[model samples]
Target: MTTVPRSLDEIIASADALADRFEAYEPADADRDSVDPTTALWLAASRRAAAERDLAAAVVEARRAGVPWKVVGELVGTSGEAARQRYGRHAAR
Candidate 1:
Protein backbone atom coordinates (compact mmCIF):
# COMPACT_ATOMS: atom_id res chain seq x y z
CA MET A 1 0.00 0.00 0.00
CA THR A 2 1.13 3.53 -0.66
CA THR A 3 1.94 5.88 2.18
CA VAL A 4 0.97 9.53 2.53
CA PRO A 5 3.43 11.84 0.77
CA ARG A 6 3.64 14.25 3.71
CA SER A 7 5.61 13.51 6.86
CA LEU A 8 3.57 12.82 10.00
CA ASP A 9 4.55 16.22 11.38
CA GLU A 10 3.46 17.97 8.20
CA ILE A 11 0.15 16.10 8.26
CA ILE A 12 -0.33 17.13 11.89
CA ALA A 13 0.49 20.72 11.09
CA SER A 14 -2.06 20.70 8.28
CA ALA A 15 -4.69 19.35 10.62
CA ASP A 16 -3.86 22.03 13.18
CA ALA A 17 -4.16 24.71 10.52
CA LEU A 18 -7.58 23.39 9.57
CA ALA A 19 -8.66 23.42 13.20
CA ASP A 20 -7.48 27.00 13.59
CA ARG A 21 -9.40 28.03 10.47
CA PHE A 22 -12.54 26.26 11.70
CA GLU A 23 -12.27 27.94 15.12
CA ALA A 24 -11.88 31.32 13.47
CA TYR A 25 -14.77 30.87 11.06
CA GLU A 26 -17.83 33.09 11.56
CA PRO A 27 -20.40 32.24 8.94
CA ALA A 28 -22.62 34.98 7.52
CA ASP A 29 -26.23 34.43 6.47
CA ALA A 30 -25.11 34.22 2.85
CA ASP A 31 -22.45 31.65 3.77
CA ARG A 32 -25.11 29.28 5.10
CA ASP A 33 -25.84 28.02 1.58
CA SER A 34 -22.23 28.00 0.44
CA VAL A 35 -21.43 24.44 1.46
CA ASP A 36 -21.77 21.89 -1.31
CA PRO A 37 -23.48 18.64 -0.30
CA THR A 38 -20.97 16.53 -2.23
CA THR A 39 -18.04 18.32 -0.65
CA ALA A 40 -19.50 17.91 2.82
CA LEU A 41 -20.06 14.21 2.34
CA TRP A 42 -16.59 13.72 0.87
CA LEU A 43 -15.01 15.53 3.80
CA ALA A 44 -16.85 13.40 6.36
CA ALA A 45 -16.06 10.19 4.51
CA SER A 46 -12.42 11.13 4.21
CA ARG A 47 -12.16 11.92 7.89
CA ARG A 48 -13.82 8.63 8.77
CA ALA A 49 -11.31 6.79 6.60
CA ALA A 50 -8.45 8.58 8.34
CA ALA A 51 -9.89 7.74 11.77
CA GLU A 52 -10.17 4.09 10.84
CA ARG A 53 -6.54 3.99 9.79
CA ASP A 54 -5.52 5.63 13.06
CA LEU A 55 -7.51 3.08 15.02
CA ALA A 56 -5.96 0.20 13.13
CA ALA A 57 -2.46 1.57 13.74
CA ALA A 58 -3.19 1.97 17.43
CA VAL A 59 -4.41 -1.64 17.55
CA VAL A 60 -1.11 -2.76 16.07
CA GLU A 61 0.81 -0.82 18.70
CA ALA A 62 -1.30 -2.19 21.51
CA ARG A 63 -0.83 -5.74 20.28
CA ARG A 64 2.90 -5.18 20.05
CA ALA A 65 2.87 -3.99 23.64
CA GLY A 66 1.28 -7.36 24.63
CA VAL A 67 -2.17 -6.03 25.24
CA PRO A 68 -4.85 -8.71 25.01
CA TRP A 69 -7.39 -8.75 22.21
CA LYS A 70 -10.19 -8.83 24.77
CA VAL A 71 -9.08 -5.52 26.20
CA VAL A 72 -8.57 -4.09 22.74
CA GLY A 73 -12.10 -5.13 21.87
CA GLU A 74 -13.53 -3.41 24.93
CA LEU A 75 -11.63 -0.24 24.23
CA VAL A 76 -12.84 -0.29 20.64
CA GLY A 77 -16.43 -1.01 21.71
CA THR A 78 -16.60 -4.52 20.27
CA SER A 79 -16.13 -8.15 21.22
CA GLY A 80 -12.70 -9.77 21.25
CA GLU A 81 -13.55 -11.96 18.26
CA ALA A 82 -14.75 -8.93 16.37
CA ALA A 83 -11.64 -6.93 17.09
CA ARG A 84 -9.43 -9.85 16.19
CA GLN A 85 -11.24 -10.37 12.94
CA ARG A 86 -10.97 -6.70 12.05
CA TYR A 87 -7.45 -5.77 13.09
CA GLY A 88 -5.66 -9.00 13.87
CA ARG A 89 -4.03 -9.25 10.49
CA HIS A 90 -2.45 -5.85 10.90
CA ALA A 91 -1.11 -6.87 14.29
CA ALA A 92 0.12 -10.26 13.21
CA ARG A 93 3.86 -10.87 13.39
Candidate 2:
Protein backbone atom coordinates (compact mmCIF):
# COMPACT_ATOMS: atom_id res chain seq x y z
CA MET A 1 0.00 0.00 0.00
CA THR A 2 1.08 3.56 -0.64
CA THR A 3 2.31 5.53 2.35
CA VAL A 4 0.64 8.68 1.09
CA PRO A 5 -3.05 9.11 1.62
CA ARG A 6 -5.27 9.78 -1.42
CA SER A 7 -6.94 13.03 -0.30
CA LEU A 8 -7.24 15.82 2.24
CA ASP A 9 -10.33 14.14 3.61
CA GLU A 10 -8.32 11.02 4.32
CA ILE A 11 -5.66 13.03 6.10
CA ILE A 12 -8.26 14.73 8.25
CA ALA A 13 -9.86 11.40 9.03
CA SER A 14 -6.50 10.08 10.18
CA ALA A 15 -6.06 13.11 12.40
CA ASP A 16 -9.48 12.59 13.89
CA ALA A 17 -8.65 8.99 14.55
CA LEU A 18 -5.44 9.95 16.32
CA ALA A 19 -7.29 12.48 18.45
CA ASP A 20 -9.89 9.90 19.35
CA ARG A 21 -7.22 7.39 20.28
CA PHE A 22 -5.48 9.95 22.42
CA GLU A 23 -8.68 10.75 24.25
CA ALA A 24 -9.39 7.09 24.81
CA TYR A 25 -5.96 6.49 26.32
CA GLU A 26 -5.39 9.76 28.12
CA PRO A 27 -4.91 9.60 31.86
CA ALA A 28 -7.66 11.18 33.88
CA ASP A 29 -5.35 13.18 36.05
CA ALA A 30 -6.72 16.44 37.38
CA ASP A 31 -3.37 18.18 36.96
CA ARG A 32 -2.15 18.65 33.41
CA ASP A 33 1.47 18.69 34.62
CA SER A 34 1.07 15.28 36.11
CA VAL A 35 0.51 13.43 32.86
CA ASP A 36 2.67 10.34 32.43
CA PRO A 37 5.04 9.63 29.54
CA THR A 38 2.57 7.45 27.68
CA THR A 39 -0.13 10.07 27.96
CA ALA A 40 2.26 12.74 26.80
CA LEU A 41 3.16 10.69 23.77
CA TRP A 42 -0.50 10.28 22.93
CA LEU A 43 -0.97 14.04 23.17
CA ALA A 44 1.98 14.64 20.91
CA ALA A 45 0.74 12.10 18.40
CA SER A 46 -2.65 13.79 18.39
CA ARG A 47 -1.06 17.17 17.72
CA ARG A 48 1.16 15.75 14.98
CA ALA A 49 -1.86 14.23 13.27
CA ALA A 50 -3.70 17.54 13.28
CA ALA A 51 -0.70 19.39 11.91
CA GLU A 52 -0.15 16.78 9.23
CA ARG A 53 -3.78 17.01 8.16
CA ASP A 54 -3.63 20.79 7.86
CA LEU A 55 -0.35 20.71 5.97
CA ALA A 56 -1.56 17.99 3.65
CA ALA A 57 -4.69 19.98 2.82
CA ALA A 58 -2.68 23.08 2.07
CA VAL A 59 -0.27 21.16 -0.14
CA VAL A 60 -3.15 19.58 -2.04
CA GLU A 61 -4.85 22.92 -2.64
CA ALA A 62 -1.61 24.58 -3.64
CA ARG A 63 -0.78 21.82 -6.10
CA ARG A 64 -4.24 22.02 -7.62
CA ALA A 65 -3.74 25.78 -8.07
CA GLY A 66 -0.37 25.24 -9.77
CA VAL A 67 1.67 26.58 -6.91
CA PRO A 68 5.19 25.17 -6.90
CA TRP A 69 6.33 22.95 -4.04
CA LYS A 70 9.23 25.28 -3.32
CA VAL A 71 6.84 28.19 -2.91
CA VAL A 72 4.60 26.12 -0.74
CA GLY A 73 7.58 25.07 1.39
CA GLU A 74 8.65 28.68 1.81
CA LEU A 75 5.14 29.61 2.88
CA VAL A 76 5.24 26.85 5.46
CA GLY A 77 8.69 27.95 6.75
CA THR A 78 10.59 25.07 5.18
CA SER A 79 12.87 24.81 2.19
CA GLY A 80 11.21 23.97 -1.15
CA GLU A 81 13.48 20.98 -1.30
CA ALA A 82 12.25 19.72 2.04
CA ALA A 83 8.62 20.18 1.10
CA ARG A 84 9.07 18.21 -2.08
CA GLN A 85 10.93 15.54 -0.20
CA ARG A 86 8.16 15.22 2.30
CA TYR A 87 5.04 15.69 0.16
CA GLY A 88 6.01 15.13 -3.44
CA ARG A 89 5.49 11.40 -3.26
CA HIS A 90 1.91 11.97 -2.20
CA ALA A 91 1.27 14.30 -5.13
CA ALA A 92 2.68 11.72 -7.47
CA ARG A 93 0.04 9.22 -6.51
Candidate 3:
Protein backbone atom coordinates (compact mmCIF):
# COMPACT_ATOMS: atom_id res chain seq x y z
CA MET A 1 0.00 0.00 0.00
CA THR A 2 1.11 3.55 -0.65
CA THR A 3 0.70 6.48 1.70
CA VAL A 4 -0.81 9.64 0.24
CA PRO A 5 1.14 12.88 0.55
CA ARG A 6 -0.58 15.36 2.83
CA SER A 7 0.55 18.89 3.66
CA LEU A 8 -2.39 21.07 4.61
CA ASP A 9 -0.64 24.39 5.27
CA GLU A 10 1.60 24.11 2.24
CA ILE A 11 -1.34 23.31 0.03
CA ILE A 12 -3.32 26.21 1.45
CA ALA A 13 -0.41 28.62 1.02
CA SER A 14 0.11 27.54 -2.56
CA ALA A 15 -3.54 27.95 -3.33
CA ASP A 16 -3.61 31.43 -1.79
CA ALA A 17 -0.54 32.49 -3.73
CA LEU A 18 -1.98 31.19 -6.95
CA ALA A 19 -5.19 33.03 -6.34
CA ASP A 20 -3.37 36.23 -5.49
CA ARG A 21 -1.24 36.00 -8.62
CA PHE A 22 -4.24 35.32 -10.79
CA GLU A 23 -6.03 38.31 -9.34
CA ALA A 24 -3.02 40.56 -9.69
CA TYR A 25 -2.31 39.61 -13.29
CA GLU A 26 -5.84 39.65 -14.51
CA PRO A 27 -6.37 41.77 -17.61
CA ALA A 28 -8.24 45.04 -17.39
CA ASP A 29 -11.00 43.65 -19.58
CA ALA A 30 -11.48 40.60 -17.46
CA ASP A 31 -14.98 41.48 -16.41
CA ARG A 32 -17.71 38.87 -16.02
CA ASP A 33 -17.90 38.47 -19.82
CA SER A 34 -15.05 40.21 -21.67
CA VAL A 35 -12.24 37.58 -21.77
CA ASP A 36 -12.45 33.99 -20.56
CA PRO A 37 -8.85 33.27 -19.62
CA THR A 38 -8.91 35.33 -16.44
CA THR A 39 -12.22 33.82 -15.50
CA ALA A 40 -10.85 30.34 -15.98
CA LEU A 41 -7.78 31.15 -13.88
CA TRP A 42 -9.94 32.57 -11.15
CA LEU A 43 -12.04 29.43 -11.18
CA ALA A 44 -9.00 27.19 -11.06
CA ALA A 45 -7.54 29.10 -8.11
CA SER A 46 -10.84 28.88 -6.29
CA ARG A 47 -10.87 25.16 -6.91
CA ARG A 48 -7.37 24.84 -5.53
CA ALA A 49 -8.37 26.67 -2.36
CA ALA A 50 -11.42 24.44 -2.02
CA ALA A 51 -9.32 21.33 -2.53
CA GLU A 52 -6.88 22.47 0.14
CA ARG A 53 -9.74 22.91 2.57
CA ASP A 54 -11.08 19.48 1.70
CA LEU A 55 -7.70 17.88 2.28
CA ALA A 56 -7.35 19.57 5.66
CA ALA A 57 -10.78 18.29 6.57
CA ALA A 58 -9.78 14.81 5.49
CA VAL A 59 -6.69 14.97 7.68
CA VAL A 60 -8.86 15.92 10.59
CA GLU A 61 -11.15 13.03 9.76
CA ALA A 62 -8.20 10.68 9.62
CA ARG A 63 -7.29 11.76 13.14
CA ARG A 64 -10.84 11.03 14.17
CA ALA A 65 -10.47 7.61 12.57
CA GLY A 66 -8.09 6.62 15.37
CA VAL A 67 -4.77 7.76 14.00
CA PRO A 68 -2.57 8.79 16.93
CA TRP A 69 -2.46 12.46 17.91
CA LYS A 70 1.31 12.40 18.16
CA VAL A 71 1.62 11.08 14.62
CA VAL A 72 -0.83 13.57 13.20
CA GLY A 73 0.83 16.41 15.05
CA GLU A 74 4.20 15.36 13.71
CA LEU A 75 2.86 15.27 10.20
CA VAL A 76 1.44 18.77 10.69
CA GLY A 77 4.49 20.08 12.54
CA THR A 78 2.89 20.42 15.92
CA SER A 79 2.91 18.61 19.26
CA GLY A 80 0.36 15.94 20.21
CA GLU A 81 -1.19 18.13 22.89
CA ALA A 82 -1.38 20.96 20.41
CA ALA A 83 -3.10 18.77 17.91
CA ARG A 84 -5.53 17.60 20.55
CA GLN A 85 -6.39 21.15 21.56
CA ARG A 86 -6.70 22.35 17.99
CA TYR A 87 -8.49 19.39 16.44
CA GLY A 88 -9.84 17.15 19.16
CA ARG A 89 -13.10 19.10 19.22
CA HIS A 90 -13.87 17.84 15.76
CA ALA A 91 -13.96 14.30 17.09
CA ALA A 92 -16.24 15.26 19.92
CA ARG A 93 -19.43 15.19 17.95
Candidate 4:
Protein backbone atom coordinates (compact mmCIF):
# COMPACT_ATOMS: atom_id res chain seq x y z
CA MET A 1 0.00 0.00 0.00
CA THR A 2 1.30 3.41 -0.95
CA THR A 3 1.08 5.99 1.84
CA VAL A 4 0.62 9.68 1.08
CA PRO A 5 3.56 11.49 2.61
CA ARG A 6 2.74 14.04 5.29
CA SER A 7 3.64 17.68 4.68
CA LEU A 8 6.65 19.09 6.57
CA ASP A 9 4.31 21.17 8.74
CA GLU A 10 2.22 18.07 9.62
CA ILE A 11 5.37 16.09 10.42
CA ILE A 12 6.69 18.85 12.68
CA ALA A 13 3.36 19.15 14.43
CA SER A 14 3.17 15.38 15.04
CA ALA A 15 6.74 15.28 16.35
CA ASP A 16 6.13 18.25 18.63
CA ALA A 17 2.94 16.64 19.95
CA LEU A 18 4.84 13.38 20.65
CA ALA A 19 7.61 15.31 22.41
CA ASP A 20 5.08 17.15 24.52
CA ARG A 21 3.36 13.90 25.46
CA PHE A 22 6.71 12.32 26.36
CA GLU A 23 7.64 15.30 28.53
CA ALA A 24 4.29 15.16 30.30
CA TYR A 25 4.30 11.40 30.82
CA GLU A 26 4.57 10.06 34.38
CA PRO A 27 5.59 6.58 35.49
CA ALA A 28 2.88 4.42 36.99
CA ASP A 29 3.10 1.09 38.86
CA ALA A 30 2.22 -0.77 35.65
CA ASP A 31 5.23 0.82 33.89
CA ARG A 32 7.69 -0.10 36.66
CA ASP A 33 9.76 -3.34 36.35
CA SER A 34 7.30 -4.96 33.92
CA VAL A 35 8.27 -8.10 32.01
CA ASP A 36 10.28 -7.09 28.96
CA PRO A 37 9.23 -9.11 25.87
CA THR A 38 12.77 -9.50 24.52
CA THR A 39 14.15 -10.62 27.87
CA ALA A 40 11.22 -13.01 28.35
CA LEU A 41 11.81 -14.55 24.91
CA TRP A 42 15.56 -14.90 25.63
CA LEU A 43 14.84 -16.64 28.94
CA ALA A 44 12.34 -19.02 27.26
CA ALA A 45 14.85 -19.82 24.50
CA SER A 46 17.54 -20.54 27.07
CA ARG A 47 15.19 -22.89 28.92
CA ARG A 48 14.22 -24.64 25.66
CA ALA A 49 17.90 -25.16 24.78
CA ALA A 50 18.65 -26.58 28.20
CA ALA A 51 15.66 -28.93 27.93
CA GLU A 52 16.83 -30.08 24.47
CA ARG A 53 20.31 -30.80 25.80
CA ASP A 54 18.85 -32.76 28.70
CA LEU A 55 16.67 -34.77 26.33
CA ALA A 56 19.70 -35.56 24.15
CA ALA A 57 21.69 -36.72 27.16
CA ALA A 58 18.83 -38.95 28.23
CA VAL A 59 18.55 -40.35 24.70
CA VAL A 60 22.25 -41.11 24.66
CA GLU A 61 21.91 -42.93 27.96
CA ALA A 62 18.92 -44.93 26.69
CA ARG A 63 20.80 -45.80 23.50
CA ARG A 64 23.89 -46.96 25.43
CA ALA A 65 21.71 -48.95 27.85
CA GLY A 66 20.45 -51.00 24.86
CA VAL A 67 16.99 -49.50 24.73
CA PRO A 68 15.52 -50.34 21.31
CA TRP A 69 14.64 -47.63 18.89
CA LYS A 70 11.06 -49.01 18.80
CA VAL A 71 10.61 -48.13 22.48
CA VAL A 72 12.20 -44.74 22.00
CA GLY A 73 10.07 -44.11 18.95
CA GLU A 74 6.90 -44.99 20.88
CA LEU A 75 7.85 -42.56 23.62
CA VAL A 76 8.81 -39.78 21.26
CA GLY A 77 5.85 -40.34 18.87
CA THR A 78 7.98 -41.18 15.82
CA SER A 79 8.76 -44.27 13.81
CA GLY A 80 11.52 -46.60 15.05
CA GLU A 81 13.62 -45.94 11.96
CA ALA A 82 13.14 -42.22 12.34
CA ALA A 83 14.37 -42.31 15.93
CA ARG A 84 17.34 -44.45 14.93
CA GLN A 85 18.14 -42.17 12.03
CA ARG A 86 18.15 -39.14 14.30
CA TYR A 87 20.04 -40.58 17.30
CA GLY A 88 21.72 -43.86 16.26
CA ARG A 89 25.10 -42.16 15.95
CA HIS A 90 25.05 -41.38 19.66
CA ALA A 91 24.53 -45.02 20.53
CA ALA A 92 28.26 -45.81 20.41
CA ARG A 93 29.15 -42.89 22.62
Predicted model with the maximum lDDT: 1
Return the TM-score for each candidate structure. 0.65, 0.56, 0.40, 0.57
Expressed as tens digits, the lDDT of each residue in 1-93 for candidate 1 is: 845548889889878988999999999998987779999999899999999999999999999999999999999999988999999999995
Task: Kindly list the per-residue Cα lDDT of model 2 for residues 1-51, writing each as its tens digit.
Answer: 746667999999888988999888855567756879998999999999999
Order the candidates by TM-score, highest first — what do you get? Answer: 1, 4, 2, 3
Clashing pairs in 4: none
lDDT of 4 by residue, 1-93 (tens): 844449998788778988999999999998776879998899899999998687777788988788888998887789889988877776656
lDDT of 3 by residue, 1-93 (tens): 844436998778778987999988855554645658887899899999997677568667877688898887887789978877877776465
**Cα lDDT of model 3 overall?**
0.76
lDDT of 2 at 38: 96
- Superposed by TM-score, candidate 4 places the C-alpha of residue 51 at a distance from the truth, in angstroms, of 0.8
Q: Candidate 3 or 4, higher TM-score?
A: 4
Among all candidates shown, the one with the greatest TM-score: 1
Clashing residue pairs in candidate 3 are none
* Clashing residue pairs in candidate 1 (N, C-alpha, C atoms within 3 angstroms): none
On the 0 to 100 scale, the lDDT of residue 28 in model 4 is: 93
Deviation (Å) of 66 in candidate 4: 1.0
